[model samples]
Target: MGSSHSTPVAPVEFDHHLVSALADNAAIPVPSPARQSTIDAHIHARIQAELQRLREDEATVRDEMHAALEKENLDRERALAHDQDSAASSATLLADLDQVRAKVDRFHARRDLSQLPALREARDGLVVCYKNNTSTPLDCWQQVETFRASVSELEKQHIQSLQ
Candidate 1:
């Protein structure tokens, strides 16, 4: 049988605290105060610039909205003024048309008299009778009474036909 020999192993001592400290230091960055302040200032400047830009944009939008509203109000006022002018003109035109219609109605009434020669003659004769005798025309003339009775009978017949 061969003899077997084993060498004794030495115990090694490790500084765990030093290793842990080194590892902690390596994991976290520690900046100088001046550098940190400079970085903070840069960040602050960027934030302030962004805020100022946002404020300017908001003011621009507000101005645009105000201008738009003012323009709309102006347009509405113009439209209303135009409508009023048109209404005034229409009223004047309507009045003129009514006056013209009254003249036309007078002409039509004269034309209707022309169409009824007998009525026109009877009316002329009655006028003459009244002119000839002012106080006692009814007793002297029968034409006026006949014309009135005819008109009344014609109106009654027309009403009865409608019913």
Candidate 2:
């Protein structure tokens, strides 16, 4: 019901006196020398301790899972082997592994390579940025993030692709 225009009008004004936060040299609060040495140390220590505990728990869980899986796999293999022993004319290693599942794992692993280029490019860009901006390492933050993201994605893909 209102008038239509090609460009919309702004409710606010854009003034010439714009201030950049980076350009502002305002004072920031800091701890004293002694405090600075220990500032956030407790938090950091707690974080490291928690990380270690989690890592240990993960390893324990992984081991238990691995053992359980292996035991399960072994049981299945033995059953299959028993069946094969009863019916099969000859025994072989291939009898233990399911060919269809193996093929699927292989196919997934092959398809998972699609992101390798992006990962490599991110790493190369990070290296180049580091070389060019040695004085300002912060410039490489984007590249670092890209690389981390790519690595994380690849890890997830690998985990999913695992047989």
- Candidate 2 has its poorest 10 consecutive residues by lDDT at 16-25
Q: Write the per-residue lDDT of candidate 1 for residues 28-145, one digit (tens) a residue.
A: 9888999999999999999999999999999999999999999999998778668978778878999999987876675556456566665677777778878888878766459787
Clashing pairs in 2: none
lDDT of 2: 0.78
Least accurate 10 contiguous residues by lDDT in model 1: 154-163
CA lDDT of every candidate: 0.78, 0.78
Number of the top TM-score candidate? 1
**What are the clash counts of all predictions, listed in order?**
0, 0
In candidate 1, stretches whose alpha carbon ends up further than 4 angstroms from where it belongs are 1-25, 85-163
lDDT of 2 by residue, 132-157 (tens): 99899998888899999988997787
In model 1, the Cα lDDT at residue 105 comes to 74
